[model samples]
Target chain A: MKTRQRILHYTGEVVLILFLVIFLIPLIQTFFTALKPDIEIYKTPVHIFPQHFSNVHYLHVFTRLSKDFISFFKNSVVITTVSVFLILGLGSLAAFSLARIDFVGKGFIIFFISLILSIPLIITVIPIFMMETAMGIKNSNLGLILPYTAVYLPIPLFIIYNNFLKVPTELEESAYMDGANRLQIFTKIFLPLIQGGLIAAAIITFLNCWGEFLFALILNTKRSATTLPIGIMMINDEEQSWALGPMSAVMILSIILPMSLYMIFQKNFVKGLMEGSVKG
Target chain B: MKSLKQGKKIRDNIVGWLFVLPAFVFLFSFMIYPISRTFILSFQKFNFVYDSKPVFVGLSNYVEALKTPSYLTALKNTLRFTLWYIPVIIVLGFLFGYIITLPKLFSSKLAKIVLFVPMVIPISMSCYMFLFILNPQWGLVNSFLANTIHLPMLVRDWMNDPRYALKIIIVVTVWQRIGFISLLFMSGIQGISSSIMEAAIIDGASAARRMWSIVLPNLKETFQIVGILAIITSIKLFAQVVAMTGALGPNSAGGPANSTLTLYVATWKAAFINFDMGVGSAMGYLMSLIIFLLFGLNFMLTKSERA
Candidate 1:
């Protein structure tokens, strides 16, 4: 029986390691493919590992598709960075207000957001698209940014609220007694206290904005306004023969910024992510 | 003091709204406003190809969408894929999370990073990866079956068959999303204490027994969270499909007898490719209604279960 239990434990470990390898292979394939030259991509039974890789594709992507690639990269970076900042800044205050301040309609507002957050995003898609087209901003960066914020709002706010609820009411009362106004109290005391939660929220919001696909695709058809995902997809969609290498390069390019940003803050990434997931 | 407090409260409210103003305006403009317009636009007939004036046509657009055979087909495919995708993502993801929690076995951190990487990559990229792997022309899998499996015909065009195409679409999309759901389940699982499981184990139960009897019962919260995210993300399974199909859309019957055409892709083609914004908007509205009905019961079930 003791030997049987040890065998089960060993079996579990081996299965997990194999599963881990399966998970990492795509990331590995990405880099391996990125390093390979264009000539190798079309070779039958395409080289899983190029015998000799050149940086030519990367340079080609940089120099040839540079203008289009960089612009889309810039667009994605700007939207993600700005939207993340807004989600954290706004999500913090609103969560605080929602959590601490007892006011009329607070329960309804909380309930509404909770309900809205739970539903699959299809509910608002039609309304948002119609609204954007009517306002004549359907194809602009504003179009992508707006929807991304709304979609990401609930999770961050939930994070902040959860963290806030854990703090004792005395913290707020102490600040009040110190003659600090409510805004100052919130900005100075509560905000700083929830810094870990805020970092988690900001990192998550940024990731969401960075990865957003649907709105970015539909709202920005024009090349100049294109975000990275659309740019990569659009290039492949153009039916160019040498589409694979350049498209892969673009795919790598678009995801690198977000991926690196994620890697840097990966610890917070899981924490923020896991919190958001269980709530909804 | 009372008046002073009132004035201070007013100021706080002002500052608070000011902070939240950007997010509110952004959501209002893009989310709230566009949704409102789509509701109204679904009633208007617009010739997208000719760029004609959109005339308000009441329920006629909805009626038109309902009459179309493809609308039903896309709806059927969407539900089928959702059904296929959600159950596996939720169940396997939960199981993986449960296994990782067993005695802290060999560090879940590395496992999580590797697992969730696909969730972050461009959908187009993963689409390409799967496309290459499943390609019939000396593709990796085809080559494998030809040599090892010893049947050249068994290396079928995975993406070209109607019956197989939808399943491939469902599988590909589910693969991209499973990592994130698993990570989520892990986090939620972590929040659950091991004492309950310890009690069960001490009671002489097997791990599966512990999982079913104690772990799973405690994991209801995680289940709810993963359930919602899975169903929700599965709705926008478009860019990847379009990438796979070469974007001819309904123009070429969406390939393999149009079996892979999702509601989003169909609606997109209706507006842009077919150039019928009326039908497109109608497609969007109808799709939303269908998603609501299918997921609504699950949502309410989870909600009521929580209460």
Candidate 2:
């Protein structure tokens, strides 16, 4: 019986290790391929490890590739930062109001948020495209940023709202009695208390805006306004689908920020995901 | 005193409205207005490139969508993708979830982190990575099979083959998502009461038996959540198809004989590519209708459990 239990435990460990290796193969392959000299990319019996490492692809992406590549990176950063800031600001305020305040039409507002959550974003793309084009904001970063803030609002809003609900009412009441107005209490007391929730919302919003493809694809046809994902697609086109090395470099570049954020704030991400899903 | 309290109430109302007004303004413009317009547009004939004005054509767009072969194919392909995607994701998710949560496993933390790496990266990056691995000429899979394993006959052009194209897309989507789903399931497993599991262990139940009789029954809510999410994800399948299959032509996504064309991709092609907004709008509503129906079905099935 003891041996049987031991056997099961060892087997499980082996399976897990094997699965992890298999799971990470694509990512590992992409990293290796990115570093491989251009000539080795097309070599037969594709080597998992690069024969000779080359920084040419990386250099090409950064220097030799058209000025558009740098702009794509910059555009992704600016758009994601601005949109996430908007989401956190508007989301936290609305969440605070819905969670803490007694007001008319509160139930209606809650229902409205949930309704928007259920509707998929694809349904709105066409109209948004037409609207943005008519408004002359199409092919611009602002076009994507505004819609992203609006569409991605409900999830973070719910997360932050639930966070506000978790804060003790006594804290707010005491602050109120101590001469803090609503804004003062909110900014000073509530914000610090639910810092975890706010960070979680920020990380989630950042991830969404960073990787967003559909709207970026449809709305931003101009090279200057394109985000990373669209830029990668454009790279595929510019390379005429043959230059895997530079494409892999761009892929690595696109993932670096999100990957680093995930490594650092992984706990918040899990917390945010679970909270959003459980409540949503 | 009454007047003062009433004044405070009014102030609170004003404050709350002020707080909510900014978010509502964005949501109304971007979400609500577009949804309502899409509804109206579904009932009209408009083409961005060809038409000067939208002519009212009530019910015809919807009727025509039901009749069009390509639209029907897209609908069929979406359902097919969903059918394949949901079960595989759920089952693998459960298995990985169960394995990662085992108390005796020393590497559980590492496993959890590694499994979730795919979730954090951009979907397009993953899809493109798979494209490199599955590229016909120099792709890793083919070269490895033919050169390393000497399985020359087994190598095929994966992305362009009609028979394999959709399946490969499913594989890529599953790869991107399975980690996240597993984590969700892991959370669900952890949510189960520890005492019940301890009792089963003391009673000398086998691990498989314990899992079946205890953990499985306790994971009902997780299954429902994961199921609905799978359905929704499968329905919104766009990026994977676009990235994996590559574009067949200008503004077209589903390719290699339309085998991988999904409703979402088809809608994009129609509205944006083909400049046929009417059919696209109707298809969008139809997609929403399918989602609502599925949600209703899920609710009904779970109603008894809740009660």
Candidate 3:
């Protein structure tokens, strides 16, 4: 019986290692291909390493596609950064009020947030596109920014609300007694207390906005407004193709942003992501 | 005293409104208004760039949408796609996550990094990466298969063939998503106390027995999270399909024969391509209703647990 168990364990570990390799090879290969010269991209019996390793792809994108690249990159960065900023700023206040303040029908309002967050925005794309077109933001960055912020609002709001609820209101009450204004109390105490939750919320908000594709694809048709993902896809087809090298290089950098952000707050990001999922 | 209390309540209400006002403006402008107008447009069959005004006809647009073979195909394809996708993502994520947590090895950390790399790369990046990798000629997949396994181009023109296009979408989606889901599961597994596993081991129970009886049960809560993510991600499945097979799948409306176009993608064309806002709106609403019920049940059940 012990021998049989040992055999099973060895088999499982072996299989697991094989599966992990299979899963990661494509990604690793893509990174390797990024260093290959553009012309060598489709070479058969593909070389695992680039024959003539080139930084040209990286340099080309930075130098040649600089304006378009920088603008689109900025579009993603500014929208993601600011939306998260406002979402946290407003979300914390709103979450605080809901968690602490006595109000009529608080349960229903909180319930609404839950419902809103769960409903996938895919069903509402038609209406959203129409609204954007009408607002003259159909192919504009604002169109992308506005809806992305609204649709994702429930998440940060929910996190902040739940985290706030866990904080002992006794502290806030004590602050109230000590003559700290509500603003002062929030800025100095509550803000510092929920910093982890806030960071997690911000990271998620940023990732969602940055990785957003569908809305960007539909709303931002012009080169000026399109995101890196959409831009990459558009350049994928046809001659003068951005080539596999630069494409993958840009993709690698794009990935680094979210990867680093996620790593910076891995625990909080994961915890916050799973917040609404696990409790039930 | 009554007036003062009412005034303070009003002030709080104002503050509340102010707080949500930014999100509200976005919701009203983008969601409510567009949805309402789109719903109205669906009732009117407007030809794109040709018809100035859509003629108001009730339910005809839906009838038209349903009658089209492509619509039926899209429904079937999406169902089939989900059937293939959900299981792989769920099983692979859970299985790989379990293995990754085994007594830390020399390469476990490096494996984790590589496993997660695919996730951070945007869907567009994956789409392009896979395109080069999966190309029928001189593509990495075919070459690797030919040289290593010697399969003699088991797949050629994958995107152009209806049969294979869906597979490509499913494969890419699974690959792109598996990493993230696995990482999520790894964390879920970590949340379980090791003492229980250690306890089971000390008692001389087999690893399989312990996993089936103990670890699986503890991971149920996390499984629920994965379940919701899977369902939500499944319905909104767009980028992978669009990126892989082009505008609508290559052969058909979704293509290789309407094989890759999902409900969301279909709704997209109906609005943007066909300019039939009403039908698109109705489709969107129908989709939302369907997804809402699914998500709502899960949400309520989760909430009820809280109660």
Candidate 4:
């Protein structure tokens, strides 16, 4: 029986390793592909290993892709950073109100927001594009940020709402008993309690805004205002046939921040996703 | 004193509304307003560039979507993708979730991180990675199949082929997203109390029996969430399609004979590419209707289960 258990355990380990390798191969390929010289990229028999390493692709990504590549990166950083903070701030306030404060039309507000959230981006982009263009905000960071904040508001709002609901009422009640006003109580007590949810919401919102392509593509037609995904797409479109190294390098650069952010705040991301999933 | 109390009551309501006002303002402007406009546009022959004065077309746009062969093919493709994609996602999600959680799997942390790398990498990049690897003649997978595996018959251009284009896209889509779903399922599985499992074991329940009777039932809500998300994500598959097949495919947006054209891509082509706003808005409404019904069904199912 002991031997059988050991065998079963060994089999589990083997299966785990096998699956890991299968999954990691593509990522490993991307890493190696980014390193390979143009000569090696298209070579016959598909060399997985680079015969000679070169940084030409990396150089080209910085120098040759576009004069506004850095601007694209900057735009993405600025847009994502602004949108995430707005979502968190607004979402938390709304969530706090809905969760803790008994107010008129709460159900209607929640239901309406849910309905609004369900309207997919494809359906709404036309009007958003036109509105932004009409308002003269199109091709600007504000064009993307406002719509992103709106699009992402519901998810974080709901996540934070659930977080607030789960907070022990005693914490807030004590604050109230100690002569705290509603605003003070919210800021001083409730905010501190739901820090995890806030972090999770921030990370998720940042990731969403970072990866957002369609609206960013449509709204920001100018190269300077575009985000990383759009920049990457432009690169892909320009050099569809080859330029694998530079393309892969740009791709790698675009994701490094988000990937590191994910790794760092992964626990919050998971907690937020799990909570959002369950509630949603 | 009563008047002062009334003032405080009004103040409370004001504070409440003030707190929620920002999100509500944004939601109303971007989401509600645009959706309402899209709905209105669907009924009118409205092309911003062409139509000087938009004329009411009634259901003509919907009629166009129904009648147009490309739209129908897109409809079919979207449905087929969802049908094929969701099960694989669910199964893989569970399998990976379960495997990673096994205590016997040495260095599970590294394995988990490997599984998660795909999720963190943007879809555009991942598609490019797969594009290189799945290349027909000189790609990694094809070469491996021909030389290492000795299976020359299976070798083919995956993305360009009409038959395999959508399927390969599905594979790539699943590969990128499965990590996220797996983590979700892992959490759900862990949420299932170990004490319940112990009770099942004490009752002489076999592992399979325990999984079926205890674990499966407990995972119903997770299944619902994961299933709905999978459906929504599948429907939203546009960028990957663009990344895999360049914008200028044979039929445009859907690659070689429009085999890979999805509803979202079709809608984008209509509005943006074709500059036919009315038809595009109509397609958008139709897509929204399908998504609404799917979400509604999910909601109703959960409601019924609770009842």
Model 4 ranges off by over 4 Å: A240-242, B1-9, B247-251
In candidate 4, what fraction of native interface contacts survive?
0.67
- lDDT against the true structure, each candidate: 0.72, 0.87, 0.73, 0.82
Q: Write the per-residue lDDT of candidate 1 for residues B1-307, one digit (tens) a residue.
A: 9999998787666765665556566556545665666677788888755755789888998898878898778778777878988898888888766665556566455566666677667676677777766768735567667775677778788988887887877777777877777776776777778787678778899967876777677778777666656666666667767777764432543457878777877887777677677788888777666557856777688778679
Q: What is the iRMSD in Å for candidate 1? A: 3.3
- Candidate 3, DockQ score (0 to 1): 0.41
lDDT tens per residue, model 3, B125-237: 67777776776875777787777678875857777787788888788888877767887788878888989979989999997899899888988877877877787677777
How many clashes in each candidate?
A: 6, 0, 12, 0
Return the TM-score for candidate 3, rounded to 2 decimals: 0.87
Candidate 1 chain B, run of 10 with poorest lDDT = B246-255
Report how far off residue A278 is in candidate 1 (Å): 4.1
Q: TM-score for every candidate vs. truth? A: 0.88, 0.97, 0.87, 0.94
Question: Whose lDDT is higher: candidate 2's or candidate 3's?
Answer: 2
Best by DockQ: 2
Which residue pairs show collisions in model 4?
Answer: none
For residue A38, model 3's alpha carbon misses the true position, in angstroms, by: 4.3
| Cα lDDT of model 4 by residue, B1-307, tens digit | 9999888778778888999998889988988888888899999897778877669989999998889998889889998999999999999998888766766568576667777777777677688788768867657898888888889899887877899999988998898888789888888888899999899899899989998998889888888878888888877889888777864431355786788899999999888877688899999988888889998788798789789
Report the CAPRI category for model 4: medium
The first chain of model 4 has a TM-score of 0.94
**1 against 4, candidate with superior DockQ:** 4
* Lowest lDDT 10-residue stretch of candidate 1 chain A: A118-127
Best by TM-score: 2
Residue clash pairs of candidate 1? A127-B34, A127-B35, A128-B34, A128-B35, A131-B33, A131-B34
Candidates by TM-score, descending order: 2, 4, 1, 3
